[model samples]
Target: MEQLHNKNTHGVVRFITCGSVDDGKSTLIGRLLYDTKAVLTDQIQALTKTKHARVTASDAAIDLALLTDGLEAEREQGITIDVAYRYFSTVKRKFIVADAPGHEQYTRNMVTGASQADVAILLVDATRLDTSKSNISLLAQTKRHAAIVKMLGLKHIAVAVNKIDLLNFDEEVFKKIKEEILNLANTLKLPTPQVFPVSALLGDNIVNPSKNFNWYQGPTLLAWLEGLDISSEKSGVNLRFPVQYVARQDGSAAEDFRGYLGRVESGEIHQGQQVTILPAGSVATVAEIYISNGLNSFGQNTSVEMAKAGDVIALTFSEDVDVSRGDMIIAQDNSSDLLTKQLIADICWLDHDALSTSRKYILRHTTNTVFTKVKNIIQILDIETLSQAVEADSLGVNMIGRVELALQKPIAADLFDESLATGSFVLIDEATNHTVAAGMIREAL
Candidate 1:
């Protein structure tokens, strides 16, 4: 057995397991954690003693699903209701795994988990599918989840035909399922997904290959994950820094010390880099960069020469420009034009109440929030057929649709396909202060 290590040579890979309810999503995650020795002995003992533990003929097997089904309701009902996240690392790579709920009502929860994931491991229950039919119909929940992930721009997808052991590890059944999955992907315009036949319960073809199936010849699920190239698409892009806070040393010895504090959403910022402040359209050079040490009582910050994406730092400009909290800073030379008051976006309706076009919503994108109205409900997407319906005027809860939005003012944003950080926004109900929808900008109209 390979020893588990905390250090990783490759960067972290965030993935989510999603499928219909009772499809063994939780079991697959638990098996990965168990095989990698991520779970402690005490946790294993607790699993065996739990009332929900699965009983075998010889002994009470450790209920691996219990490792991620942490909520009381989840344990009592034996279903994942909310998204549960777990972290584990190997010598090759680090992983952050999310176990998403599979129910139709909780589709919003699954979207939340998939938004941050680099890859999605879609679990399919082999026993529940009928292979005798010429046209195999997948569960509605499965199609919905798959569509949502594709809409979210997840480039990598893997289908795990789970519970293969129930069919006596039959190779023909696995092939049928794999064929259906490919058809589904082609219909959704998604890239070809890597398919695997595995038994999450018995831990076959997950971390290690099983001798039960000699015909199947593919890397184990863990091996494929470890070898994936997780290099960010954001690399080589121009800088995009959204100003969140403005810090000033009023009583310090040095006068005119103004720092714009926020995270570098993309690209890099150097000390002498020339950047343009958006909306205001003012150009200034970066004078100094200070890496924020978080909240300190002494108010001391370490000055740095440069900062890259994912870094939260304070930047000082050469000129005293009128920079505000909601302003964005980008490279002046190569940045794309982004100022626009109208936008076309794809949205996932998340509220209990249906979307109303006349109602006004607070559109929060990055550090900026603006009042906006839904100008038009362009079309509603049919998840089953992957088609668009233009007749719908209103969108119900957990629906995905395209709409045109009219903002109060122009804001700097990129297309969702170009930059997820700047192109995504959430619609908030003004009266209830509840997030009603999550939107991705498709075009600046």
Candidate 2:
């Protein structure tokens, strides 16, 4: 029921770079930060230290990787082991860039990055385009990461053909790579990805135009990113505000000061608006809305006429209604007919142990956790082929599959394509209490 709009007053665009190992993801992010002059003097000075290895041979030059590869272990190995997030701003917009690990073992980390991204930069190494050998080569991680980002619902994808310097900035090589990427996108039914020939290490066609590639006339990566309409991608289609706590101001004068505290995941709520409480459809009118100073530190209760999606506030009802933590308050205008206990979901298995139907796990949706069991593994998707292996019994580490989940209690939810906030859930291991899987509801059973 939330109205979709464009351009948040703050121009922030969140994106991620992912591909095979040694594909220069960290370097690309580092170069973006460096070219934008976002790095500080002390950080630049630290890069000159003997321990920080520079990518180029120049003594005065700094290795851009040092700006992102923060961990000691990652620096020693010269690889990104986890998701490295860096914030910077250009003249046109602010940016949050996530440099995801390229190794196949860290696919879960890539998924974490993809979950929050509005756009994705799929990096491809120029050297990996070699096709003269008898055996054809494919970057498995690149394909896998592409599938993961697409599956996670990112519509804007940019294919950066990196390391063009190594190929002498060959126009034909760029064409070949671009064509191959287009073919792959077509096979996956993904939106057409804009291709750019870039050298993250050499700083070509990233923040500035590359003089080397005369044939390339499109906007630079930064320019393209600045031009994107990311406002519509910030929130989902439905209103979902899950109550985290209930604040009661008990006093002789403030007798009517009882409020439900929560962050609006999506959609907006207004004062005197009619709202429905979910899992128990009780209707109530919002008497007052108060924006708190902090999550726990509620110093000043600033009364507001309305609260938009993403605002953390408290709602006082006109009529005293029984509401508690884990309950949801949604707009009464939600049109989805879905209200069920069984769901068909697409899941990314993150646990070391495979997923089994017989085992019970805790399914956490919004703030509510309930017992759940995997009733059946319908199919496992092959990332490269874009084909499903029908009738899979279980899912292994990093494998993506569609399964039937039986919940102990019924929930008011929506299709993932309808609303991401209400249609997603996480599977937690009973024994280790670790998040073993992340899932998106495809449909109700």
lDDT of each: 0.86, 0.83
Model 2 accuracy (lDDT, Cα): 0.83
Candidate 2 residue pairs in backbone clash = none
Model 2, span 1-445: residue lDDT tens: 1223446534678899999999889999998999999999898888878385846555328788879999998998899999989999977888889999998888888888888788899999988767454333458788888778767777789999999988899998788778888888887778899999999888999999989988999999999999887766536556778898898878886564787888887888998889888878888999888887764554335688988876778888888789988888888886355467999999999888999789899998877788999999999988767788997887998888899999998777767766666778889999999889989899898
TM-score of 2: 0.94
Q: Model 2 off-target regions past 4 Å?
A: 1-5, 8-10, 52-60, 133-137, 233-238, 298-301, 335-338
Pick the TM-score winner: 1
TM-score to native of every candidate shown:
0.94, 0.94
